[model samples]
Target chain A: MKGASEWDRHAPSSAPNPRHTRYHPRWHRERIPIFWWVGHRRYTLFILRELTAVLVLYSGLLLLAQLVAIGRGPESYQAFQGWLAEPWVLALHTFVLLGLIFHTVTWLNLAPKALVLRVGKIRVPPRAVLVGHYLAWIAVSALVAGALVWVAG
Target chain B: MSPVAKGAGGRQGTEPERVTRSREPLLWSLFSAGGMASALVLPALAGVLWVAVPAGWVAAPEHGAMLAVAAHPLTRAAVSLLLILFFFHWAHRFRYTLYDGLQLYHLNLLIAVATYGIASALSALALWIVWTLG
Candidate 1:
């Protein structure tokens, strides 16, 4: 919590001090290159994971826009649908779909790290946790799809 | 002034501005919740809205039906929560992305405020839209 001023006060004095002349050999820590993430596969994957948030943001905004369009009435909703029919919009959505899939898969895979299950003194395997997540995901998706079908019919 | 008093003053003066201002835990918690929510629902949303409807694999809902869905109290509340969490999730992710990706550690405060501020504003707009839907 030391302020910058405090750090400055205790900084190595520019003026040479007799007491500060001890020489020591130490390995130089590697500087994080600007492209450090690109240099490592794991780091690259982490960055991609983080970048999925942009897709989430885009999707959220799109949902809001759709809601606004719906509020404005049928013509507005039709206009919005027309806009979405453009090739560029479709392409953007394709990318968003990929990003969303990546996000979902990664999140599910990481679920075991956050959720530890044990029963009767036996710890659940990570694979079992992953299976549980996938099962729950499918169930929820089916529920949503079923609801939509029920509503539409 | 006594040396002890001067020392105390110096110690107080040198405390880093950010030391007392960390919101890491709060932001991380929101990000985690948002991630879980998005994981649960977003892919299905994308499938329905972007894939099935657009590709003509399924019929698009009539405007009246869509409106009805949006106007439902439960739908409105769920959507509002989802959108708010999504924004916070984006804020937290983008903050770290800039910090590590762009090496913007020196401008941490500015970046944090900008990211979270935008999220807050958008969340407000989203809530307003949901709340006012007929």
Candidate 2:
């Protein structure tokens, strides 16, 4: 774009060079504002999806803390459980649950696009992919719940 | 003036150019695995731990049983993998969030380092906790 205007730029377009093909970027994206995602519904949902990364990150850390508490002994573990029982913790978990559920639903919807499955010759349909994700989610969730309940009993 | 191509060696006065192999694919794989794992099981786990058990909607598992399960080598390994994948997922998502949402591409390298650094550090912590448990 820089040198094209001053010279015979149409030379390449009109009579293409068989040997060399010079490349130039055609699309120029405009600068966006910092809070660009705040206004639109779709954009806002994207932001929420991205923010769930933080939720999961903290959740990982909390799991680590629980493990450490477990290693510390029963008394320390009880204290950790007691700490979680605090009203503020529950309130925080309320939002955490919402954000994580959003993450799950949205991520599952994207499974079809990400995973292009095929059995031998025929390509798997996107609907099947979506259904498979939901089914897997349900199965895994049930497995975790069942494991915990089994341990309790 | 005739069109001249730039040299592959970079500028005359600048430092020597370095060929970089991007680790994007590997990071994305981790992110994908993490996203899937978290999405599948996190809601139920979070509900059980942070809400149901804490809020008294459900009974908590016995201490001995929990300790026994956590002590198991299989459980420890599974948890370690989960934590590592989860952290990488966070790193990738948060990195892009800052890149696109706030348009902070100028600090691209720094943001990348910081986000992945946190992930790596926390992953080590998670591993240590799991290894030392039970």
Candidate 3:
């Protein structure tokens, strides 16, 4: 490989092999920010958007599977339950929980800006939107959890 | 809306003041509502579903029951509805991300329309498939 100075210069006018002489952006060794790689605005936002629905869809599938097992005889349900009892499933659940938390944070952060709820002169801050979403998420999650505990009890 | 328009599409001289229109808010409003509901509902439901599995309050479905549940008309309808609304919210949100993030002038409207159109069309296809043979 040529020195940085050599790479900086334009392709030679008499280079026999044009492709080799041509300077690639990589030749400059410019460090792209980690955020630039798929973490750029489009992909990051796309993934963030999809992650929520994906969680919902996967959860739906999981719940539907359990519901089906329940619909079957007790024996079948027990077997499916055993599978869920595995350590792997617990690990997966923990991972999903972390993902959900991330989703909630990003979603709430974007929520105010997304809604763009504004007054005449002073616009509502994005942080306010996020705080509102957090309060709602916490309340709803608590209510659902409470209801589940009650039913399960 | 300022009269000192300097961007590529901004008017040169004295265009009608009426021409200064804010972007449409109808779709944005609908999406905001739907997003809020989904953001609230899904996470809540997820918690319920998660707990029920461990507590044995809800029986686990065999693969067959899972398939059958998918086959059920109500379940199929719910899934399809979720898919459509999710896509609508996603496309709407992403369009703004593209506009604001990339600063692609003059293409924002086109991109937004295209994104939503594709999402809607795909969602329709998914609904049709699930409804027919979910």
Query: Number of the top candidate by DockQ?
Result: 2
Model 1 chain A poorest 10 in a row by lDDT = A13-22
Residue-level lDDT for B123 in candidate 3: 72
State the lDDT of candidate 3 residue by residue for B46-126, as single tens digits: 545554555455654344444565668876777667666656665666666655446454565567668678767867666
Q: Rank the candidates by TM-score, best first.
A: 2, 1, 3
Off by over 4 Å in 1: A1-29, B1-22
> Once superposed on the true structure, which residue ranges of model 3 sit more than 4 Å away at CA?
A1-53, A119-122, B1-38, B51-134
lDDT of 2 by residue, B1-134 (tens): 11221332222122111111257888889999999999998999898888888998878776788899999999999999999999999999999899788877556666778999999999888888898877
Scored by TM-score, the top model is 2
Model 2, stretches more than 4 Å misplaced? Answer: A1-29, B1-21
Q: Lowest-scoring 10 consecutive residues by lDDT in candidate 2 chain A?
A: A12-21
Model 1 chain B: ten consecutive residues of lowest lDDT: B11-20
Index of the highest-lDDT prediction:
2
Q: Kindly give the stretch of ten consecutive residues in candidate 2 chain B with the minimal lDDT sum.
A: B12-21
lDDT of 3 by residue, A72-144 (tens): 5567667776777677876676566556666666667777766777789887887787788789988977875
Task: Give the alpha carbon lDDT tens digit for every residue of B15-86 in model 1.
Answer: 324332456688888899999888888888877787667766677788888899999999999999999999
TM-score of each: 0.82, 0.83, 0.48
Query: What's the DockQ for every one of the candidates?
Result: 0.43, 0.48, 0.11
Q: Interface RMSD of the predictions, in order shown?
A: 4.8, 4.8, 9.4
